[model samples]
Target chain A: MKLKQLEGLLGNLDQFSAPKIELEQYPTGPHIASRMLYTAENSFEDVSDKVVADFGCGCGTLGIAAALLGADHVIGFDVDADSLEIAYLNAEDLELDVNFVQSDIRNLQCRGKIIDTVVMNPPFGTRNKGVDMDFLSVALKVASQAVYSLHKTTTREYVKKTALREYNAKSAEVLCELRYDVPKLYKFHKKKEVDIAVDLWRFVPTPTVESDV
Target chain B: MRLLTHNMLSSTIKGVSNGFPLTIEAAKVVEKQVDMNSDFLKNIFSKIEWKPFVEAAKTLGFSELPEEDVQPSLLDSHEFLTKFHHALLEIHLEEGALVCPETGRKFPVNKGIPNMLLLEDEV
Candidate 1:
């Protein structure tokens, strides 16, 4: 399927009702998710036959696309039970063989599984500073290959710098610019749909050195 | 919880390092025949961890899989593919408990959903 075709399919999935503030739950727009998945499919490493994860998967947009694109297996991780209910329903509706795991990604554990790639739209840390980095920190450690994380367009340089200095990242690149619509969930959002700048950042996760080996 | 999901699940609670291949205790098992996609099955063969697949299959009472791992060449066999398809996609655990190997924590599976929520203290 073409990029837009994927977006059309993902666009049909259910969305959140009242997203929690602490989670900073903003679903990745269908267009961005489709384009990112497409790029990942055609770019460096194809998600096909790879164990792909969608961390902070609110209703499983990225992960479902990976499954649709023929990822060997897809797992959607989220802390909220309510979000997971909708995600499971989406997967069931699509008849896709994907699983939703309810857990805080930071504290979640997957022993012995080597995740080939991670596609996630984590919290940008708008309400809570450094929350985005927290997602990156865990993604770097858990993922064996690379992480495709979405960040605010303005923080591209800061994100790239930190990935290099902190994780000794092998490589980092700004894959694409995505125009996200921040839905008015809280009292703060004035407009019904507000367009914002978001960048899809791909990073080669470097596991911390283990001297015990 | 299907074995495909079970294959990827681990207990990621803080302090527990070895949280892989959680043991399954099925209170309910449902069989739903999803259309077979040979192309997808062919691609995912190599990615499947043979031991975990066999172990999980055994727990779910579908022990028809071979004791030894089938190689990449087995992807060509119709019988193998059919069996693989059944084991991977058809079998489903509507209710169960995925037990953490190290922590022995029970993650409940209700109505085919596995709840992996960790307690506040656990996190």
Candidate 2:
């Protein structure tokens, strides 16, 4: 699909009706989401005909994008059941067959290298420290091909260091930086809207001996 | 959830070792047709645990998958690929529970999404 067309479809999907502070739920805008998936498919061939997963899939935006891009199978994982409900409705509206599971990303007990690619907009760890790292850690393990995620631009050095050294990733590269428009979803936000610079990262995991074992 | 998701998932409650291939309690099963891709099925064939996959398919009332482990060359067969595609992606557990093998704890599946979150104590 054309990038413009993909963005148009994602623009119509439902977002969080009630944002949760603890989970740091922020809707992934169509602009960033379309660019992320478009790059993954066009540049790296990670979406189409591959098993793609969306971690902490809020309202199923990224996963649905993968489905629209012709992913063979798409599974969305999220801890919030209410968000999953909205995600389910979103997929139904698009007439896309995406599977969803209600489980915390940290505690997900996925075995083997069943998934090819993982796309997510994880919590930036503002509420709970290191939660973003935790999501990256699991995504590295579950995905066999690559993991595409967004993190704060300020933490670029930290994210690269930890992903390579601690998570044992093969390679971590920042694809691009985009402005994350955070609307006033919570009372803590003093401004009507704030644009935070966030980096889109693509991390390739080191091949494991236990792959598909 | 589709069996593709089920095949990758395990019981994640703390202290439960080897909580794989969670038993299926199928209260309701639905089939949603999807376009078949032989290459995709072929790539995922080696990654799947065949016994559990066949067992799960039987539980969902489709017993066409070979019970024994088969060679990857079988993926070339159109009939086998069709069955594999249906069992893996088409059959949906609309309403059911996935019970952990170790603790027998039930994780409910509602609206086709499995709830695998554990209590704080379990975690």
Candidate 3:
């Protein structure tokens, strides 16, 4: 999609909700912050001949970006019907083909097929019950390479330990951070602060299958 | 199960602290073709956690990924999106256990599907 078109889409919204399965949604304006999109876009520059998946595809931003950035194919999954509707509209508008499925991230079923890359900005643990780790674990299981955005304060340690223990994946901290400034007038806005610190991780499966042995 | 589902699941037992990536010990796996919608994906980019998704794909034995910091072009061509769709939606773990790293909790998969059920003792 052209930058101009994207800008138009971004500008056309007054309030945008995240894909429904997530605990919360962005109150107004494009649900995603433009800066975050730019950051993610830049992050996938070298991806090629790879299948990419965008989990919790609120409005299909990441998947669209992946296609634009040269991913061989992109599939997006979300649980919200309304969000999926908007996501579909956005994909159509951009003239980029994407696969958007309506399903909970927890119970997703993709038989034997594998993708080269996966990307997501899962619910920040702080929003509801602080269980974002569940989202991270699943992402690790389905993609060869993955990128995750999380709260800067708590996610680093948790992500590190999980990556090491589960898939034996190695991680590197990217120097990028996203901060959202919420206007103070709202009841929940006691000066909202979201520190977006992302970790880039890669998994190399152990040669445990007997075929190699 | 899709990597997206694996990420949100936990051992659900009473005190399992880390249940992030449910390990798949699949006894049977299957794949299916699903429809595509590009506009929907474009709108939901921020909600994805890319790193773990990549890790999960690798575990399944796929290793082609773009480098970090590249811009995805929506208008590049149809060929690119078609290939991406196959990897992201078609891959399936028919049977497997999503083992938790912190608690050693195991969620089993039967018949190309993962059973994320937790026992009362686990909860």
Candidate 4:
């Protein structure tokens, strides 16, 4: 599907009814989401016909996008039950069969390399330090092909260094920087809207080499 | 949750080993027709654990999948692909619980979505 059409469909999906500050539940707007999934499919061929999982999927935006882009199967994982409900409705509204599971990304356990790509807009770890890395850590382990995620632009060095050294990523590269317009979802926001610069990253995990004993 | 998603899920409670292939406790199972993609079925067949997958299918009231061991050569048969596609993608556990093999913890499935969230103590 064309990028414009993809964005238009995602724009209609329901977002959070009551945003939870603790989980850093912020809606991933259609602009960045379209670009993220578009690049994954167009540039890298990491999306279509692949088993895609959306980690911390909020209202199923990214996973639904993958479905729209022809992903054979999509599974969305989120800890919040409410978010999963909205996500389920979004996928249903689009007539897309996307699976959703409610689980903390940190504790999620998968047996084999079934997931080909993981696309997520994780919490930036503003409230909980290192939580963003925690999400990346699991995404790296779960995804066999690549992980597409958004992180704070300022943490570019830290994100790359940790992914390569600690998370067993073969390569980590920032694709582009986009403006994340965060609306006043919580009382802590003094302004009506805050624009934060975020970098879209694609990290490739090191292939697990079989050994002869 | 579809059987495809169930194949990837396992219990991650504190120290439980052998948590894979969570047993299906089906109360309400629904099926939705989807286009069968032979290529996808061929690729995913290798990744699926046959015994548990067949068992889950039976619990969901789908007894078409072969009970015995399946070889990759079965992909050549369109009949086998149809059965595999239906069980993996079409069957949905609308209301059920995935019971952990080791700890016996039950993860409830509601509205076709599985709640795999562990309690704070379990985490």
Q: Per-residue CA lDDT of candidate 2, range B56-102, in tens?
A: 99999999898875999898889999999999999999998999999
Candidate No. with top DockQ:
2
Give one digit per residue, the lDDT tens place, for model 4 in A1-213. Answer: 899999999899999999999999999999999999999999999988899999999889999999999999999999999999999999998889999999899998766788999999999999988889999998998788999999999999999999999999999999999999999999989999999999999999887653110
What residue runs in model 1 are displaced by over 4 Å at the alpha carbon? Answer: A206-213, B14-17, B32-50, B68-81
lDDT of 1 at A90: 89
**Any idea what lDDT model 2 has?**
0.94
In model 3, where do residues sit more than 4 Å from their true spots?
Answer: A1-22, A27-46, A181-187, A191-213, B1-123
Model 2 compared with the native: what TM-score? 0.99
Off by over 4 Å in 4: A210-213
For residue A43, model 2's alpha carbon misses the true position, in angstroms, by: 0.2
Task: List the candidate 2 regions with Cα displacement exceeding 4 Å.
Answer: none
Q: Which ten residues in a row have the lowest lDDT in candidate 4 chain A?
A: A204-213
lDDT of 1 by residue, A28-123 (tens): 779888888888988866587677889989999999999888786678888888998988898889988787777777775454335678889989
In candidate 2, the residue pairs with backbone N, CA or C atoms under 3 Å apart (3 or more residues apart, or in different chains) clash, namely none
lDDT by residue for model 2 over A83-153, one digit each (tens)? 99999999999899999999999998677889889999999999899999999999998899999999999
**TM-scores, chain B, all models:** 0.95, 0.98, 0.73, 0.96
Provide the TM-score for each candidate, comma-separated.
0.86, 0.99, 0.52, 0.98
lDDT tens per residue, model 3, A1-213: 444454456555323343232455442223333334444455544234456777777777666666655555666776565665676677667665565655566655343234446666666666665445666666665555555444444466666666668645555454444444333433565555533434433333332222100
Task: Give residue A35's error in model 1 in angstroms.
Answer: 1.4
Comparing to the true complex, what docking class would candidate 1 get? acceptable
| Cα lDDT, model 1, residue A146 | 83
